[model samples]
Target chain A: MFLLPWFLGLVFITLGPVLVSLYLSFTRYNILKPPRWIGLDNYVELFIWDPQFWAAVRVTFFFVGWSVPLVLVMSLGIAVLLNRGLSFLPVYRSIFYIPSLIGGSVAIGLLWREVFGSSGIVNQFLQGFGIATRSWVATPETAPWTLVSLNVWTFGAAMVIFLAALRQIPTSLYEAASIDGASAWTRFRRITLPLLTPVIFFNLILQVIHSFQAFTQSFIVSNGTGGPAESTLLYTLYLYQRAFVQLDMGYASAMAWVLLIVIAVFTGLLFWSARFWVYYGDG
Target chain B: MGLAVLVSAMMAGTMVPPAAAQDLSGEIRFSWWGSTVRNAKAESIISMFEKANPGVKVSREPGEWGSYWDKLTVQSASGNQPCAITMQSRWLAQYADPSILQPLDDKVASGELDVTGIDSAVLDSGRGSDGNLYFIPHGVFYFTLFMNKTAIEDAGMELPPDDWTWDDYAQYARDLSDKLPEGSYAVGNQGGAMDTFTDWVQSHGETLFTPEGEVGFTKQTVVDYFDFWEALRKDGVTETADQMAEIPDNIIDDTLLANGKILIDARPANQVDGHQKVLDAAMPGQELVIHSYPVGPSGTGEDIGSNGLAIGATCDENGTKLTEAWINFFTENPDAAATYSSDNGVVSVDRFRTAQLENPDTTPGQYQAVNMLSTVGPRAKSAYFPSGGYSALSGALTSAYETVAFEQSSSADAADKLIAQVKRLVRD
Candidate 1:
């Protein structure tokens, strides 16, 4: 009975739209006109005919593969550093978590563009010291990395989760290890690492999912056209280009489902891998 | 007592005409994308509409340009579209289908919408591909170069004429850049812009799309267009790709032209005042002058289209009649038209255009721009952009431009990729 409101929302707000989009995926819909049923044509065209579809997949996968690991490792490292019994711990924690709190925000995206732009802060800072720099957004090779760096900067959220788990790890484990003559690295490797696996798994899956669907940074940096020869056309950006700019809602719907399946499969694989890596205190 | 009061009301109804008091009473939702100035003008006009017809309420929904379509698309599909939607000529064709927008001809015939003041050619442009009048253009715009007079003088160069060739443009810009400050440029690299290419192609007696809806220009035609920009880059006449990309998507504040770092840019004629205003604020001594696109060897590179109003299909029966009334009131009445005063664009009606030109408050630049547009309005043809995937084609143009300029790829390669991409989108 207590779950009634959520169940109602699932039916009306979530499930209803999901089903409509699934239905739209098989049709010829332009949003401005009536949607006509075409039965598998959109999916067929997307897979077999569209080069952009393949390009989007390649770009999105490349982004996800690197960004997920970077966030995982970096956040864990910072969390461990903060957990070393430092003064003003709460202040430091809040300061570090600020980026995550405002991660994927539009203002941050605009800020990122300014920092990476030619004649921007990055170049200004570099040149102030007599070093030359290139415009990160203009160079095709470096354009996508600007967006990656944005994601990496938001490691604070995961670090906070890691900090909480680190605090729960029963310091007796570390005390016993030290008394037994174990090295600091060895204590971390054997005790802290295993103890933090559950949080790592949590953060990793969430980060991967978040990274896959990233839109704001890429959109703002690329100036909404995803040009500079479409070098920074992330999957969601491309999906948006199709749906709104091209008015091809049917194809966009199909693209959305494909993205969903890709994310689900990746998440499933992570869970499968977790059996070997993730360890619990009780177990 | 109630029966006596009812008898007295019936007598009052006999004294007052029923048609004038309650005619076309309902609410209308009018949506448009505009600047803050435009939103204020639109709101004032809406209140004018509401005042003229006492019982009718006209709602104003104003948004900035970027997210207007993103919202419009969902609204259209959900059958929740506003009664009156502001549309562009290139986009008019997309919304022209009978199922989406109401054709305005019947209203014209019924005297509900008066089109007598608008020129015949301008009126005819409102017709969709199906020859139905689904849009009513209020005012027109043409793409032209906004040149900085002071900057050109600083560079010790003469201003280019209206009849200069492409070669002349490149040489002059190169010369201007030579004398300018080290970081400043003659212009941003705009070789990939669709409007620029359209002007070039038309001057050559070719086009982006043919009358029969096929690719109008040969591969060699587009390739030569690309090579033109490549030649400029090689000559150091244009800004580097990095410097150009530094200002993304032409935000006014970031524009090199606004910052006095660039001497010229191709802008829609109506925006001359805004550009000049920016220049006035940012670079106090700089003054801007608008001129026609360079005349090519074969033809003049000019096209024109106007912002239009379309009636969405979702309006209920009463809303439809009221929408017609609102449009007629907005376009036909000179006082109502003056409320907009070319912020929406140059006014469409002959009476209002003349009114705006004569108003002492109208700036000299705006007056000249509007005067020039009115003289050229009759001959301007809208560029032919095919519906369904035309925006993608435009994207391809910019993509090809970037590939040639930044990637150092031959224009031929970019052209080939563009042709193939266009063909693919058009194929379906």
Candidate 2:
């Protein structure tokens, strides 16, 4: 009886729509008309025909590649710095954590635009140092970097997780290392790094999944067109355009399934690799 | 005698019978897309409408321009769309099917919907691919260039003549570029603007799409159009590709033209007042002027579209009657027209347009817009976008221009890609 609610949610909320979408992937549906089955045409068109699909793939992979590692490194670094018995730690922690909560919001997207726009604060600050550059969020080469920076800026959620895990690490091991005349860097390299691997693995998988699904930052920054030469065209944003703007619900469904498979493969690979790297401090 | 004649003319111009309005009894929902100002105006008009029809009730469903279509599409899929849906002619083909919007030709014939004083040509613009009238157009919109008059005067440059050509306009921009303040460009880059390209195609005596909805213009036309803006962009007459890309379509405040960072740009004629307000706030003492687009080789290719109301297919007999009555009141009632003040587009009815033009309270921007409509309405061709063509062309054009601007592709390759992508989207 206790599991009934969860079971119902699993069936209706998650599984039902997923199955419906899977069926829709093989059909031609415009939401207004009855769906017409087209077999593998939607998938074929996506894989072999659409240039925008390829552009979206390229942009998304680039975004995920740069953002995930940068986020992991920055968050781990911040967490370590904050863990050093610092004053006003909670205040700094809250200040840093706020961006993660609001980073995906429309307001942040607009703020990012204002900050990276040609006449924006970033340009003004750069011009002060004689570093002339065009609008970062508006150019093809630089637009994705702005979004990457946005993803990296929201590293606080991972930082909080790492901080909790760092707190759970035994102080006796560090004290023993100290008695053996271990340097701070050597202690970090030998004990701290090995102990933090599981938590790092957890954050890595979470961030990779999260980065793959990232939509709102690109949507807002690009104003939903994925413009400036499709530089900011994330995979989810392209799916949204296909479904809503062009009213190609079936094709969008196919794209969604493809994304699901890609994410699954990535997660599988991560898990497989974790056997070599992740340490739970157990035999 | 003159006063009596004037009163008679006014009464003859009015389309609705005030006494007959009280017969409408049922409730209906009227949905529209607008900002707070327009919503307030719409509410005032609805209040007037409800007052005229004592037993009638109207629930408002307001939305922003971008999300309005998505919301309406979802509501339509569920067969729960509002009785009256605000529709643009550009988007009419997508929803013109009888399954989505009701055919209003029978209503027009039966006198259920009165389109009196509206031009038949404008009315015909509302027809779908099946030749069925899907909506009653209450306002007409056309594109025009808005210039910073103060900047031009300061630079000692005279405005282009009424029959200025594209070459003349380009040279004018080039001339204006050398005299403008540093960091300001001559024009906003409009190479990707679908409306401007439509005008370009039309002016060259070619249609954007045929009656059967296929690509009507050649690839050469597309290349030439891209080259026109590319030259300006390369010469520093327009903003950099990055700066141009930064200027969003929907936000009036963020535009380079509005911020005085650019001298001229093409925008909808009806948006002059909004753009003027933004410019006025952003840079005080800057005067803005609306001008017709530069004429093409054949002639002026100015094209016009409309914002109008369509009755949803799901409405019952009574609901349909209420909707018809509301449409009649909204379009034909002089007070409602006065309240709306052509907020969406220029008033479609001749009498209301004349009234707005003659009214001293009309702002300079509104007066210029109404006058411009009067000037171009006769010559302007109806802009007809096929189902999904608007979104497809808009995306393709932006992509094509961005590729060219960012040096990813040549003009010819971009044009080829644009045509191919548009064909796939529209044919689908």
Candidate 3:
């Protein structure tokens, strides 16, 4: 009887919305009107004719491609640095982790906009160096890179995860490498790289999934304009625009399902590929 | 034990019945978004209303403007909307749908609201296609061109003649660009070319939306608009699209008249009051002027753009009465409006409450706004409420302009794409 309530709550609360959204994807529903069966019209249009949808997908992939690798490398680098003895290590760790707390927030987005904007602090400094800079947020070329930089700058969360994994490694493994007269670089290549492979894979999959759903920073940075010319129009942002701004609930629902499938496929691929490089201790 | 259980069940049932029957006097919540000055004035207004109607406590919920609509929309969707809300005209249409709002037609007919002073056009603008009003406008708002007088003088150019055409404006931009320091552009175009294009199209006797809510422009017209801006970009007279995108909301405050970075900035008339900050920042000896946009090829000497203040259908009997009273109080209350307007950047919509206009304490920029609005007031077009297909149309136009500005697509290609997109998206 006790478990029944929790089971029922899970069914109704957590699983219900997902089921409803799934149904809605097949219907022509605006919030104002009752939903009607529309079959696969939304999905058909999304795949065949929606340029903005394609644009969003392209931008999302670009963001993930640029951001995920950078975040992984940076986090791994920081984790390795912290794993070694350093002065004021706790303070440095705290300082590095602070951005993780504030990242993906509106304040951070505004700060990003200010730092990268034409007359922003970055450009002002660049001007002092006699290097004229254009608006970073406005250009098609630099906007995506700016967002990628923002994502990489907040690698503290991933770094913490990597740090924990780094600590879990047996010190005897390093001693074995030292006994073999291995240099630091050779030991890192032979032991550290293999040991960290699982963590790197985990971080890569997680970051890619999260990056696909990025909304707030791009939305705020672009002031909902998504320009210099739709360069930073991320997939989730487009979904939001369709759902809220355009009020095309049916279309947005279709997009949501597509996003789910994309994430699932990517995650499945990562799991499938794990056998090649991600080695477990017992194995 | 059975008897005790029965008694407890009866007690719970009785408790619910009485609560349902109780009188409807409790806390009432009112929410709005505005500047600090507007917030304070709104607080006083709420207090006065609360005092007038005893037994009801009012809670004030205010926030900065940008995030206000998103918050309100979510609340309305969840059926948790505040009893009263301050709404903008642009968003009134989207929320007026049946699921989101209540109707106020009965309240209007019953004479609960004094609608005589309110403009009928403004009233009509608030009505949804289904004939339900969704929100009441707080005040009128229209765009104006504000200039730094010192920049014009420094450029050795006379103040642009009132009838200056697009060609003349372009030439003036060239002159100003040459005279200004190397880093500064002649003009900073805010809201992008879409805003300027909309105004240009409207002035040229073309409408962005048809009567049936379809996009109403030819590909050629859009191309011409893009070409105009592209030429200016090529001339290096106007800030590039990238440069304009970089400007923060507070750019109006930072660009001083004396330093001459921005010669002219297009902004809302209501924001004219905030030019005091600009004046304070101006080089020691520069002057400022506020004027209407220059006459375009298609624009009659009249300005045609957005102005605020429309009533919505959500006002019930009490809501209507309260809203009418509130509008009149905000507009007609000289001391309140003057204090509010001076502190905030807006010019008072109510002409009768012209105390600030006549007062010597008002900034020159403020007076210039008053003068320009007075001249263009009669000629101002009734603001259009973009109905169903408007967002797609706006997106198309924005995309077209951005494509040309970024040089990713030629002007012709952008125009064709825009027209095709509009045709595909617009239902009616």
Candidate 4:
């Protein structure tokens, strides 16, 4: 009974837009006019000739490749540290989680620009340390990495989930491993590693999807143009440009569907790989 | 008996007055994008209008420029478009559908909307692709390059003449940068800007697009333009490629020009007021002077454009009537015009434009804008921007220019890339 609203919302909100976007992918639509059925023209145009589309794909791929693993490892490591019954545990959790609370907003994106900007705080500190500093966000080659750092910094949510998973692992198992003459690394590898696979799998899939859809950080950093030579043109930002700025809804829809398929394939591959490594508590 | 007949006829005819057209009573939904200042002026005008003409209400829907079009496009398609839709030249065609904005020709003919104080060319410029007046511009924005007079004097360099060539502009910048404080630039970068490119190519006797919807300029044009900017960068005249990328579109804010870090800037004449204010705050008495775009190498001309109000398709008779009244009041009234202070570009009404400049309260930017408009006469020509083509072309222009700006591609290669990209878009 409780799931009824969610199911309704899925159909009306999530699934509805998805279906419409899929259909629109095959049409020629500009927002001002009625959509004309063009039958895959949009997709053909995007794949065959749209240089920006290809650029966006590369940018998105680059972001995901770096941000996901960085976020996962950092979150897991922080979670492990917090799991150690340290004094003032709650305070530390709140302090660390603050960055995540403001994650991926335009405000944070603007903040990231300042933090990584030319003559910004980072440069001040670097110059103080007798190191030469260059504008990180303004430079095309380093702009995306600034965004990646921002994404990695906001790892508190994943950290919290990992912490919860850590607490659930049987304390008896760790005690038993200790009695069995196992070292810290050995016990962690034998018992904790296998037990945490499911959570790791969950976090990986979630982070990958989130990282793929990243837009705001890049959009804000690049001043909505994906500038300094299209170096920071995240896929969603490009789609948004096509959809709203250029008024090419059909092309944007095609881009959207392509992204959806790519994410779906990755998630499917993750699930397929899951049986080989993810250990269930029941087993 | 004759006198009585005449008196009866006169009484029946309402000869003294046309029986004050029923006080235009209705709610008009006015939408626009602006800064806080524009919004405040518009709202105050709205209230004054409502009070003077009882029973009328104006539902204001103001926003920032960045998201204005997104909201307008959605509202237009969704049938929720406000009765009064604000229109900018670049985005005008995107929303100027017969099904979106009612052609104002009929309104103008019937005297429901007045255009007497506006020049016919300005009125005609608002015409849709169908050559019908679907939009009515209240103001005009002439794109002109500005010279920070103080910066030039500080650099001990004289200002370039209005008819200075592109080469002269660059040489002047180099001279300034050589003497100015370190990190201070001689000119602002215009590598990826379509507007600046338009000015360049126009001077070269080719526009980005011809009247018949063909790409007017050649690949060589793009190469030469890229090379011109590259020369500036190489000579340390303009902002570094990295610093160039950090500009926040609006010229009035925390920019090198405001801070007196750059002497020459390409900005709309309308932005002068805000630019002057910021300049005063940053480095008082350093005024911005408007200069004509460097006569293109080909010696062609510059582009003229404006922002205006368009009546939406969904507006009912009463809503449109109220909108017409409100638009007229805002345009023709000296008080309203003075309050706006050429903020929405130079006031389109002749009387208002003259009145604004003549007012002592007017900012230096407004004064410079009016001066530039009068000075750049006949040399300014507004181009036709087809909806999707303009935005896509702008994006492509950015990509091509970025290649050269970032040192990732040669000027020739970047030009070829730009030409091919524009061709693809125009063909589509």
Candidate 5:
């Protein structure tokens, strides 16, 4: 009973801003002045009229659609490959993980720009192959791909987690598979795959959340223009534009809440479906 | 114990005398954002102010430009704005909300602020929507086209005159695009900022906002602007919005002046020094020049804006005095202004401070920028109040421009949509 104050403090301090943001989502607050209650006007505008918001949503989904699967497969593949008794495995692991460590940073975004820009290394390489490259960053078709490649290139963090999960699988499980005359592919499917389901579920939830809230790389990469016609404008980037650039804090709050709902729903869906495929040894 | 005694002795020696000490003895925090060069200059200026005024200490909090605003906004929203701070003209309106920032009218009227020599037009830039002066202009700025002489010369074209038309500029761009290396762009627009669009709109005799706070341009005017960019995009004369957007500011500088991948770039007049670095990198021997913006159909001429210093309303009397002194010291102190403005590639607002303009250490390009600003400064449009729903209007225009330029939508379609969007945005 004595700790009630502390508990209330913790709850209010931690959740106060979030609750305020949620409430502000329905109003017209520009941070400079008092918030005017506008009911669901902000949400209505976002859903019914705002093309930029829709563009951001489309770009975000495209980013997640391409990036999530690529990250999952590449990281899992790299982790599985590292699980083998390869020479200098630790060095390779570090090398693969380095991009992940720095991938979401402004520095990496700057690097991505350099690599894919018109006069960048990628263009120079393409020129060597007798391919005349125009602006990769300028094209609607290729700009989204550039962001996808950026996320895929940073598979290092997921790879590390997958590696740890791979290590946790008992050697006896593989041995049993081998005794049963299981092929390498079969053993991987029956033993390694099932055993790693929980980790996969965890990674899926994490990656989706990370991908949904991505802002820095796209912001930096696009220089806050989000172009070739808003192809690279992510959801968070739009939220930032609304919040800071436009100074429509209330609208930005609404967008933030919407994003929260999006992440929540996606995460919930992953957890719900986990029961179907995510095997738990304890259960 | 010996270390503690020594520390106490040093502190006691440095402690302010009670008779000399005012009631405001605690540290007063101040913040601004600028490059490392500007930061050093600011530090020196603050030190000078502190030395001149005892009992009051000013703490410096600075960051890079983008992060600086974010931090300051978050802080201000939480009722924690610094007593004195730097702000941009566009942002003064939002930040000067009486609830957040204290008004400076009393100080200005009492002659606490020396606004005698400052340009009245420039002073008006700091005025909020409520007609209260919220900030004071630190430096005046205008937009200009910084050109790579080698690239233009390489294209076998002479440099356009100071008053070249957009049509002539487009022709030159087309010629440059064809003549330059395959990977090179004729010109690149920084699509992120509204400067390019604003310049375009002004050239067409349209303003971003109307007198009554509506969008000034018609649907047709927007279409014409979009069409112009679309033509450039189709002709391969300009970098796509995505391409231009992806280029970091530094790399964009390098691409134009350093690598000669681009022949022309548009930037604020004050940024000539930074652009010179790009030129120095790409073309060490080549001369860089700042020319007037291409004349648009409307002939509204070039847009000029500024960043300025402001004293918060929350400051006490002593704080107010210190704020005035700081502003005077920073702006009117010829040597301090020269030192800061020299590296900044901008002319000091103080007309008497010719040190930067005449400095032997100043680059040829820097000197040219100074001359350009002086020559064009009088003609530049004074800063105006940002329109209500200006962000939405600007965003709609930018989106329309990009959409049309990238061939995702027709110019007419984009223009119509933009007009409708702006009307709706302003209406609400």
Candidate 6:
């Protein structure tokens, strides 16, 4: 009896729409009328007929393939630098962490546009060094890189997590290594990296998932049309365009399900590979 | 006997009373797309309406242009759209069905909605493909070329002649480009602008879409249109593709044209006043001028559209009456028209158009826009956008142009791709 509200909320708010969307994936639903079932048609069209779908896939894969690794490396590097005993560590950590909190927001997306724009601060700084530059966010070849840089800029969240895990590492191990006259680089290579593998694996899976779902940055940067020859057409942004702008809810639903399955497969692979590299202190 | 007397008086148009007598009591939801200035104007006009009809209450739901349609679509899907919806003629076919929007023809035939003084051609622009008038057009809009007059004068070049053709337009830009200040272009790149392309197509004696809702213009026309802009870009008469990509066309504050980074660009005729204001603030002493699109082989193939109001299907009888009354008040009421100041487009009614033109208080930019519309309205052909046609064409045009601009595809290849994408998207 006490769980009625929670149960009702779960059923109505969460599961209901999910199931409805599953049904809608196979139907012709434009939201204004009752959905008409047309089995496998949306999927068939998405795979064979739609050119934008392929473009979306290419853009999303590029974003995920680059951004996830860059973000992980940046966060780990900064975390290592800050993990050493430093003054005002909390302040530095806070400053570094703020970007992650607001990075996915519309305001940040807009700020990123202005900052990478032709006459923006980056260009102004480059111009001071006598380097001419075009608008980084506008060029089809370089536009996706701006978004990659934005994702890397928000490495603060992972950095904080890494910092926490670094603190949890036993000081005795380092002391023993010092007594054995192990070099700093050797200590880091043999001890620190292996000990941090679990956390690295965690951050990797989380970031991979996060990067796959990215939308706002691409949407805001491209002005919602994913222009400049659809260079920044993220998968989720295309889904949004199909569902909202084109009013093709059924196709969007199919696209959503495809994305879900892709994420699932990728996650499954990550887990299967984790046994080989991820350390849990069991050995 | 009293009821009979009231009915007879109402039918005879003799016993006219305020909203209370006409039974116009109840609140109706009204939604529109605009900026803060337009929102304030709409609010004041709505308040004036509420005052004149004391028993009526209007709930305002203003939204920005980009997200307004998305929100409305969601609301419509959930069956909660506002009683009164501000619709554009280009988007009318998408929601014209009786399930989404109420056909206003019945209201007009019943004398409940007054479209008096509005041009019949403009009224027809609001009709869906089914011949049902889904909306009442309050403003008629067309495209025009906005020039930085100060920049042209500074470059020691005269504005293109009134009878300038596409070639002459390009030549003028090229001539001006050589003399303009550093870092400024002769024009903002408009190879992707759908309306400009429409003008180009129409001038070649072709329509953008057939009456049967198929792609009307040939791929060769598309190729020629692209080549026109490509030639200018190659000659440094326009901004770089990347710079053009950076600036959004809708936002006046950041537009290259308004910021004095470009000598000329195509913009909606009604936006002259807004653009002038931005230019005034952004680059003081820079004067803005409005000119019709350059003539083509056929003539000025200008296409006109409209911003108008429609009633949602879910509106109750009382809500419908209130919506009809609001529409009538907006259209027939001179004060409302004057307050609106033709923010969206030129006033559709003849009297209001004339009044605004004659009013000394009207800014010169606005006056020029209205006068330009008057001159072009007779010759301007209204394009009938099929369901999903506008959005599809807009996206495809931008994508196709970008591919050409970035050297990824030739103009001919891009045009072929554009036609294919449009065919798929529009009919999907």
Which of the numbered candidates is closest to the native, going by highest lDDT? 2
List ranges where model 2 is wrong by over 4 Å: B1-22
Per-residue CA lDDT of model 1 for A53-82, tens digit only, reads: 776777777778888899899999999999
Model 3 lDDT, residue B222, Cα = 78
Q: Which ten residues in a row have the lowest lDDT in candidate 5 chain A?
A: A221-230
List the candidate numbers ranked by TM-score, top first: 2, 6, 4, 1, 3, 5
Tens digit per residue, CA lDDT, model 6, B123-241: 99999988999999999889989988887998898877788898888888888899977779998788999989989999889998887789999999999989999999988889988
Clashing pairs for model 4 are B272-B365
**DockQ, all candidates in order:** 0.50, 0.77, 0.34, 0.61, 0.32, 0.67
Better by TM-score, candidate 4 or 3: 4
How many angstroms is residue A98 displaced in model 3 relative to the true structure, after the best TM-score fit?
3.4
What is the overall TM-score of model 2 with all chains considered together? 0.95
lDDT of candidate 4 over B6-102, digit per residue (tens) = 9998887754222124566778788989989889989888777777677788898999987888888889889999988788776676766788889
TM-score of decoy 5: 0.85
All candidates: TM-score: 0.91, 0.95, 0.85, 0.93, 0.85, 0.95
Q: Give model 4's TM-score versus the native structure.
A: 0.93
Candidate 5 root-mean-square deviation in Å: 8.0
**After superposing candidate 6, which stretches have Cα over 4 Å from the reference?**
A1-3, B1-23
Which segments of model 4 are wrong by more than 4 Å? A1-7, A179-181, A281-283, B1-22, B297-300, B420-428
- How good is the docking of model 3, by CAPRI class? acceptable
Give the total clashing residue pairs for model 2: 0
- Ranked candidates, highest lDDT first: 2, 6, 4, 1, 5, 3
The interface RMSD for candidate 3 is: 2.8
- In candidate 2, which residue pairs get closer than 3 Å at backbone N, Cα or C atoms, i.e. clash? none
lDDT of each: 0.80, 0.91, 0.69, 0.81, 0.75, 0.90
Residue pairs in steric clash, candidate 6?
none
